[model samples]
Target: MSVSARDALRMAALYVVLSMLWLVVAGRVLDHLFDGSVAMAVGSHLSSLIWVLASAVLIFITRARLLSFIGLGTRRRKQDSERLRMAEAVFDTTLEGVLVTDRTGLIVHVNRAFMRITGYQQDEVLGQRPSKFKSGHHGPEFYRQIYTSLAQTGEWSGEIWNRRKRGEIYPQWQTIRAIRDDQGEVSHYVAVFSDISAIKHSEQELAYLAHHDPLTGLPNRLLFNDRVEQALGTAQSHKRGCALLLMDLDHFQSINDGLGHTLGDQLLKRVAERLSHWLGAGVTLARLGGDEFGVLLERCPHVGEAASLARDVIEHMKEPFSFEGHRLFISVSIGISLFPSDALTGEQLLRNADSALFKAKANGRADYALYTEELTAHAQHRVETAGELRRALEQNELRVYFQPVHDLTSGVMVGVESLVRWEHPERGLVPPGDFIPIAERTGLIGEIDLWVLRQACSQMMRWQAQGRSLAFVAVNISSRLFSQRGLYLEVAQVLAETGMNPALLEVEVTESAVMDDPEVSLEQLHRLRELGLRLAIDDFGTGYSSLLRLKRLPVQKLKIDQGFVAGLPDDDDDIAIVRVIIALARSMGMQVHAEGIEQAEQADFLLQQGCQLGQGYRFGRPMPADALKWG
Candidate 1:
């Protein structure tokens, strides 16, 4: 019961006692003073009634005031209870862990989330300091900084590594705030935090993926370039030499085509692993793309060190790799460029290394080449020439020249091979060797091949109109064009437009081209054969051709590469190779043609060896159709 109710009851009891005494005394006095008087008795009765009415009114007013005070007190208690429930709900249900501490930093209270996140019970950490959950990842200075900030600003928030109850370390985002009393004095501290381990892990994964190759788990081009820039800076500062090596796997495309991409990817991973194993400290190896890898050698002592490393890389790569029971042999060509010697900037270093790699590939596979100033000049020239070649095609500055092939037995011009010559207005005449490679590299070879095919066909028809009876007109096709999907359609269209017989048109592809992807090459060759055009393998002996695969090819002829022919009968190896090729062609019932016959002895030797066809400078150099001399 309320104090007000108790006081009201006491006052009422006092009034009741007084009223009883007064009633008794007044009744006696009235009886004694007005004895035997009827009027006096009546006056006494009226005075007693008036006193009773006043006492009843005073009691009613006090009771009403006490009831109003009691009701107001009850409503205030109900409101306080509701507010307590709301505070409890918020404290327990919030996702963020809440911990309250006294001014001395001892934990006083913790919410359900705090218990769940730290794996600690409320009883276990009730009076413990926040240091009890320290992961030791942050030093004393780190905590001092936080405390200093908190002291100055009354609050602090940041990422912190904390230890859970199970002794595992995790990251959390935490905010600590100081609670002050009404007098502006600090009395308590509250901390709210959330586990951010998962977010940190995701960020790390994203960062790693950005800089690494997904297939090989090797650093990618972006990372490689950044590392190169750093390495260059270090080299420049320390006055030390550094080397950049760019590597390309030789015949990797053939392996990819033959064995399938999955196996190819596995091969690349193995290759990366081997290269990484061979690298010493301070060396970084990365995959630039598709069978291409980059190596940065920091603090290299000299060029000889770079060369030695390159040689070691080549030798290691030469070792055969066995994957899924298939023994595969791989080789890499390396191009080395030095910092502050060959080039300075990261971009130039990479470019020069790539240029050297191209030279290494051209010299022959399985070798290494150092970047030279000459290579840069050549590369720049090729870039300029590629642009000119593109314009040449658009402006009709290209001309078709014919080189006649003679039947060795009859000594008669049988067929003519069509070759393109660029009549550069300023350079006079640019050889095909000068610009054809550039065209191929720039992806302009297909367009050039198409143009050559159409012009060659048109020229053959013009020669026929002039009463020249040529056996056939052969045109060289780029490897890219041979694999193109629309090659058949393009050839068909050219033939229809030129009104030439497909039987008299022969398309020549290198042995490397057909063997690159024999299945696809077979399919494409079959499509071409279906058009009634003859197909031949050019530079036959220069590539690795399996006789079994060669037998399966849809070709009618194999032209001996000029290299083997140049060293004729006196060169025993050349003689043996040529004899074997001719014998192989005869056994397969395919025609054999010998190229690069510069002397009468070479021709006589070829004829004696049973080679039926020959073409070289001896018969005639490539010339315009109007300048051709028929013999």
Candidate 2:
């Protein structure tokens, strides 16, 4: 079959011809038949032997060349048998589960890993369809899409859930390739897959940690914001509406301050549970941050419905909870913002909800309010006010006005309460009621409070140098500023700089401030008292004015709220409350001062009630320091 074999045959024929010719010629010479001459006979035999030996040598050379050509040009049957053995070895030894299927998705071949991974023997899967391993985790459309891609691209790689022989479903990372024949028709599909259950589980855990709050086990701000964005997009496309409710727990700081943060954390977890149960499945409740949460109603029917839901949340938040041997009572203020009406984006929705929350808190907490155009205006106004307040502190736009507190028995001045008033350049005089709470929220109160304290002390010293011996001068302390670290030191430094006696410097704090964080407030109060300064509870009976907490406070004076006394004599409850407070203060060795005494009857009633001090419009409106006549 080879050219070299043909050449060898031709060479063999040529050698045979040459050998025959020689033999014929030698035979002619040896024609001298076996004559009586023994030498002639021996010569003929030697020539014939030599001719046969040469012919054998030619045949050996031609055969060797023919065999060498055959070995190079053609494969032997035994080599094919060895190749089949090696391929079987590799197919059986591979670690991955290999499945060979016809183009119709039927199983035609499977390796040992396929048997191990699916817990099935080779015989069981050999003739079965690939769908036998389908866990039904994907729908028909999913498979259609996969097959379509494989048909178009000749390959596919993805994750899928498959069933094992043990009737358990597991995830697998799979790669499938289309096997083609010489005519380019798909002959089979080879799919290589491996179990990925552990990988899937790890991925789920990581996702949970990333999107859920660790302490409360609720969706955190990250996931909540994502849901809100999705809801907004859906609402926009569907021509529907959604509502975002922002809620914050009131009096939550008191829990953390009275009980440690551990107890507070437990309480928050319980609160999250309550909200999740009550908010329903359609609403997503998420813990945004400390004491604050958010809810997204994906398809709210109307703003009124959202309002009603917010109301329910507020009402439920009032329910008392007992955790870790502590009874906790908290309330929530909810702010609602509607999609496509109030905002279009997640950020705008959150901001609008926050603005409504501010309005809810300002109007009185523990209630729900809808976002309105006015609320946005008010929010912008608050921002402007905050900026102005900051500049006011830096530019000295705040001034202190002193209101004289008198001894009702002697009809003489005892001390003056220093109040800070903001003098706005454009708006003229801005009342404390308008800007004080704003300052507190904007975090600008701390600076303004310190400035007021310094100014009050300096004025008191000036009065003392003028030969006016006063009992004391009180400066109202803003609770926002009182919570800062080194507050007592700041007060002490101010007193030291002004050369004012510590005993003559009193700090008046509202009852709510003391109740905000009783533990921290008590510690600060003790520190101030230890500095030789006096403490008083201003606007008494207006907030969490508990007799138990009052007993523990280092307070020397109880200033009755003007609200109660403003409508006294006509309001029996007011009269009875005032009598009771005066009796309680007198018994505790604390002086009582009745505020807002405008009518003679009010002053007369206070005098008879054994109240020792009074201050109101009847005596004198709050005046400038220079207008005060101490003597």
Candidate 3:
């Protein structure tokens, strides 16, 4: 398919003829209409017509100069000196480099752009073979392919690497063509190329961004999984062992909330750097989304090696990270799964490691746990149970049971605690302990608490219509629900919808809920108190509540935790704690309420210890609203 000499000359003649005809016809027509000003305007930088004009001029110059530079331009003449000047300027100032060689592949003619791009002078490249520009990046086969394509197709265009005069290799997008004469014989070779180094650099940067996290410059989840798959393959092939460790920064959300997100992002970068520093050779570390990091040990020979590494990571994270003159303390929890034992596939391995990580966090943060069958079973159960609980709520299978809160001295039921019970069709009545924890963990407790609150308000209105002597009905609010900003608004709406008095509604929040964020919790509590509702801190001694914060709470009642009340009369330690709580409640002008008074002796001791209100199985177990009785 090599272009013949006659055809090449014919095409070149046609291009020049068309360009000259356009210039003559349009330039004369516009000159007659606009007094030649338009013609001059179209010939300058503001004109889009310069590209076609310049291309036609370049082809004419290449043919004439190409023959003259190789000593075969006997018929070439300077009939148009002005046009030649314009063509020469185009050849000199064009951005793309142009080179012309004889049929022998000797360099005969080069434009100014060729010298600028190749960093060579005209005298340096003249009379030399084009092969002198070879960069040594491509082998003999690469050049052979180029020659083969050019010989068969008459032209070749592709990306190539070439050397500059300064010996620096750079990429170029080049096109080379064989020029032929009227006798159908090859006369010279012409090449056009542009330095594409910037484009190549941009592509490399884009590829790196695709696989690495921009914030921390660590491998992202996509790359992390790929590395995990590779490690697993290597381990399987060599019959070695691999371990996948997933680490999470405990209480990271608190830090992010207290400080700004800018500092939080910087903290994450520092954490990634720390983890990378502590990682040993052959370990692949990655950032698996927010506040989570994954590590792969491809050569974990012993099972204890994974444990030791997890311990090291946790201990290193225990050291405070300093940023902007602030020392921020954080802890890490790690979960590990071994290859060929815990899981065979990467997906299963990550899932199992995450389950173990849940166990580590549950056991109290700053710890590590290994994968086990029980962990998988527990994870499956949680998933299945959460789904079932969602269906049960939608089907209205949830029922509220009431437990009486009795006055200790008079043994009169003053209030009822509304506790939720899931009446499963297949499992009968599911206990609160069985499903309540699941609800809390899955974040369904917020919805369930709101539903129970609405149900309790409606039931309270019914009880009031029945002339019951109960002063108030208490409903337990999970910490997840109690911390919500809209809790007060929801309660207000429920009261308005049910026509129930807010004064008779006692919302019981756990001590941990109030202590979670004292300032925010205080604001929420004050909002609820403004609605004329009673607030009580339940499970009082189980959390770390400072006396200073406790004094600022707008609550009127303290329900002592059942764990402290379980050993009331016999255990001296329980006896002292019960007395102190009663005194603490009285000193704050708050009513004292004790939970889990199962024994008569415990009730008598609590009453003697100045605990006014108490609730337990001894008085009456949790039952339906209609079944509740006071004696």
Q: lDDT for every model?
A: 0.91, 0.87, 0.89
Residues 48-78, model 2: lDDT tens digits? 7887787788668867876886786566656
Write candidate 3's Cα lDDT for 275-296 as tens digits: 8887856679999898999999
| TM-score order of candidates, top first | 3, 1, 2
On residues 1-631, what C-alpha lDDT tens digit does candidate 1 reach at each position?
9975897688878988988888888787777777677856786787689777978787688778868877898889999989999998999999999999999999999999999999999999999999999999999999999999989999999999999999999999999999999999999999999999899999999999999999889899999999999989988999998999999999787776666789999999999988888785668999999999999988787899999989999998889998799888889999999988999999999999988998998898799999999999987887899889989999999999999899999989999999999999999899888988788768899998999899999988988898889989999999878767579999999999999999999999999899887887888899999999999999989989988888998889989999999999799999999999999998999999999999989999999988999999999999998898886
Worst 10 residues of 1 by lDDT: 251-260
Against the true structure, whose TM-score is highest?
3
What's model 3's TM-score? 0.76
lDDT ranking of the models = 1, 3, 2
